[model samples]
Target: MGTGLRDRRHGRKDGGGADGRNDGSIDARDLLTDEELGLIRMEEIPGKLEEIKRALEEKVGLGVSFDLVFRVMEFGTKRTAFFYANGFAKDTVLTDIIVRLTHLDREQLVPDTLSSLLNKYVSHIQVETEDDFDKAVQFALMGSTVLFVENSGAALVIDSKSFPVRSIEEPDLERVVRGSRDGFVETLMTNVTLVRRRIRDPRLKLEIMRVGKRTKTDVCIGYISDIADPRLVESLRDKISKVNIDGIPLGDKQLEEAIISKGWNPYPSVRYSERPDVVSSHMLEGHVIVFADTSPSVMILPTTFFHLVQHVEEYRQAPFVGSYLRWVRFLGIMTSLFLLPLWFLLVQNPELKPAGLEFLGPQKQGELPLLIQFLLVEVGVDLMRMAAVHTPSPLSIAMGLVAAILVGDIAVKTGLFINEVIMYMAIAAVGMFATPSYELGLANRLVRMALLILVAAFKIPGLVLGVTVWLVALSVTRSYNTPYMWPFIPFHAKALFSILVRRPILANKFRPSITNPIDKTRQPVE
Candidate 1:
């Protein structure tokens, strides 16, 4: 039998309140640090046990169990016994332990044996003290059973946790036509296993870290041991270890900023792709991968400017077709960015046109400069985009239609702006959608306008200078100390074939050489 007794609250009113009150009534300011406070204990063992139970009930507002006592039976042995009426498990291991100790006697019991027995039978371990009541309650609530024992100032923990969980499925964002369909889920352990299953080499390493002060997000860095450069891995580990935040709401983005060399640049130094195949491809290339606990997107380091322009679809198909598609992508990028601006400027700026091309559109009736016309058209297109993004998905299409056709048609006909201006802006707007990632497309759309402003202010000379400076800055940037513009500035012959014109996978015999990868080959064994 146990008697629940409340211990006297002896700390100063100004001290750290057990229930989070700090009204300053108790002069607890200098009594002891929490480290020292956790070591204090009362001389009376049973009384202390009762006090702990009472405190737990008061603090957590839950049923406290302490009735069963330590039993000494006929055979020179001892056991702590409790009567559980929950009908949890009749043949369970815990039930079996309770039933087997019937003939034990007190003579067999010793301090060392008791410690060993508890450790051998218990499923969980937790250190407990009067000061750590809150933490103990948290563990108990998480499906751990807590035990308060007399004479022993600690609590016995039993793991009996069960929770509903979903089975893993192929990633929705990264569907493939002919590869393993398995993908990472929201679970951390499962994600690690997915990667490990693909790379069975003993040298493959998965380094884990806990970030997010509140979310406590689990992040894993993976690389091949014999294949990954040690210095690069160490540098990556150092960066991830330094991130301290309340919570990383966007897990992939959080890691990107941590490892990104050009954090301020609009061009993404780190590429995030959902497909494990893409990640594995990057890993083999000596690029480091950062897997966030929550987001399915894996951040691949040392990603170059050209990688964003290429697609996984190219590698899935034939070599000649892939090269043709890569060239098409280059053209698409040009169309997406400069098409509208050039179209608008050529038709509107009479000064830019050679004599015969002046017949392109209505002779300029307005006094507004070409720059002002572009700015106005850009603003109109932006308003339409903003409305589309914020509107409901079904309604977005309607909003887009209205903006593109209704308002735009009216604006042109009434001469608020030239029809050519609307046509040019519309082309640029469509071109922005050519990139795979929505975020990257949005970035290019923005940079194109800045490029437009330069061209409008100083024509082709200004455009050339802006593009040159941008490329120069990119060449200097590094991701995890690996060059951002890989295979381009370093000028790898094979990489140029793969990047600018993606060849057949068979022809792509060598991995990206600019990343200074530990291993330089990714050829599949025949």
Candidate 2:
């Protein structure tokens, strides 16, 4: 029982909430402070129903928090109390369970307490016994209906948690012309089901780990058991278990930071896919999928640069069509990363322009410096992108129209920017959008900006140094100790070939050895 709970915050540090001093926007009231999550007694429930209710109320803020509820009812001579969060278990579901409990009397529950209630009284699917009082409270807070019996040693946790979620729809970012419209939602179980339905393998395993002590967010590590390397699975499990954060407010985004250290690095170590089909495909290739509760996207483990640039849409088309699409996409990604800087370099040293193409640099020098003009346009485009995202859907199209037709045209005529600058920037912008992965696109944008700055400073040598540094950084970087550049640096000839060319489904027989999967062959060669 949690009756003898005391305030243990006296010796505790002042700033448990991530140093608590930096952000002025953070309201002191909202955070689950140490004083708030006081230490509770983990002893067995030795006391009767009334005493348990008092202890539970003090511990769980049963009446204090309007969303938390505790119902006391007696079936014949046996006293029972239902503890659950109001937000999770609906009144209708509770009422139905209550009707069932009414039939269970003291006689049926006398000899065996916890077992009798779980077996006979509760007819629900997810009922289980928990002895620790704190754990029972934790489960209730996480949306399970906990039952406390008179002087019972353990509590019956009925998992009837129905999270508030939206209808399954295609993800805005990962949309495709010819593919499944359904996408993963914020609800963990729903997302799990989506992936499980696709795999349909008995070997498919989902190991659940509770992260963030205060938040207690459910993080599921999904992988195919027999196929996935035990070392890889354990490695992922080990990293997630070591996370000692208080809460993950931003869901998977924050959890990712815990697993992978990104100090000013824009490139994502793991690929995130909202589509279950995309995730299932990865699992088949022996990659682990990390699903954090309240997050729509799931992280695909140990990804490469190539993995981040590709999408499921490529597979939807014919082999030839897919190959062509992939090549064009690769070209766009290259253009996004190099086009602006190369053009700027050419402009700076007009002598570098080839004999055939004298029009490589801007025709007319604008009032602003060429570099200034390029930077201004880049910042302006970024602002437009941000504005489009924040604006209402109906207004977004109109805003885009105004920016394209009115703003770009006006800037060129006013000599604020050259026509060539506007043209080249627009091409670069198109290239950025052509990238399938949003994170990768943003990363490429940052790399582009860095390249521009380097080019302005040291001319040809700066560009060379910048390129060298970028390649070396990526080459040294690892995703779960797996090569980020993979195939290219490690030089897997077959794998590199597969990446360059989208081989037909039947043509590929072996699973990617990069993940070190236990089962290598996908299909036996004829």
Candidate 3:
């Protein structure tokens, strides 16, 4: 029998309180450094139960006062205990389980009590025996119910986990005109199921692992076993396993940082998508996907510069229309990144201006230096964006009106900003909004700000230097050994051409070589 019943039978002789803490007090320092407890074997179930109960009390507060529930039940003469977190485990399911267990006949509760309960009494579809007491505790904390029977030396884990998630709806960030309105929710199981529903192939595999020592957040790696490179999968799995953190409260962003250690690099190495179709499309192309619990977004690995610029809307339309949309988006991205700096450079060196493009220069220079005015406008645009996010939807139009009419008109009239500055800035802001990847857009904004500073200090040379530095950074940066620039820096003509012009789905018969997919051919050439 476990020490729980032994201790109870012996009348609490260990000087511990009803909550299981020794001397009715535990040091906060001991609870915080509980990682030292490590893995507990099945043989140590009795002592382990006491230690876990004490730890739960010290760390999660008194069990009775907290959401954690530890209930003791009986199956004929055998003693049993149930452990679960309140909100995570479904109340009706738990009630049903208890009712069924209580009705089990004495003959049903054989000598192999744990096996008997698992094979017959437990009505849940998902039930498994966990030999490791530490893992059992972790599962119970994560929302599953852990059933411990006297002298069983193992616990039965019931997957009755339920997360408080909103209804699946269209993702605002990746909305499209003609596509599925379904989007990933905070629930990990739902997100994985969504992807699985789209890709029914047996090769599609999702490997689930726990991250964070304290949080034990569930992280999953999804990829097609045949299409995705074996080495790439191992490399990502290794990187994720090596992440030694107390908790990943921020989810995917924190996991990205841990996996890809890009020190001081502003460029986003991985692409994120909330749309299941988008994730499914990427997976079909041999890319690996990382799904973090509590996050709607999933990280697409080994993303290239071109990947960030593409959108699902392009594929939803006709081939020619898709190509046109792709080109327009590309132009907008380019304008967002370089239009202001190029304009500033032209104004700085009027001699370099072409014959017909002289009007590109501001008619009246503002009181402040051009650089300062540009910087101010950039800050103002960011401020307005932040304000709009916080402002209520009904009042957003009024906020926009105040910013566009009041702020811009006053700044120009007061000589704080030139008319040309406002025009170019507005255009740039629109281009930024047109960008598909929010991370990529923000990175471009940062790079643009840096280029503006460089252009203000030195005319033509600074612009050249800035462009060179940006290209060099891209060329050097790699996401899991795959080139960040891809096709462009390495100069693969076919791939580069495909990026410039959206290729028909039938024409894209081969997966990109960058991922080194095992199955190179996506489909039969015919």
Instruction: List, residue by residue over 279-362, the lDDT tens digit for candidate 3.
Output: 999998899999998999999988999999999999999889999999999999999999999999999999989999977798
Score each candidate by Cα lDDT: 0.58, 0.80, 0.81
Which residues of candidate 2, in runs, are more than 4 Å off? 1-41, 90-92, 104-106, 109-114, 524-526
Which parts of model 3 have CA positions greater than 4 angstroms off? 1-43, 47-65, 75-79, 150-154
Of the two candidates 1 and 3, the one with more favorable TM-score, higher being better, is 3
What are the per-residue Cα lDDT tens digits for candidate 2 across 264-357? Answer: 7889888999999999999999898899989999999879999988978889999889989999999999999999999999989989999988
Candidate 2 at 256: error in angstroms? Answer: 1.3
Each prediction's Cα RMSD? 11.7, 8.5, 9.2
RMSD of 2: 8.5
lDDT (Cα, tens digit) per residue for candidate 1, span 119-188: 5443333222322444444445433344444445544444443323356666654454666767666655
Residue range with the least summed lDDT across 10 consecutive positions in model 2 = 3-12
Candidate 2 shows a clash count of 0
Best by TM-score: 2
Native-referenced Cα lDDT, model 1: 0.58
The true-versus-predicted C-alpha distance at residue 428 of model 1, in Å, is 2.5
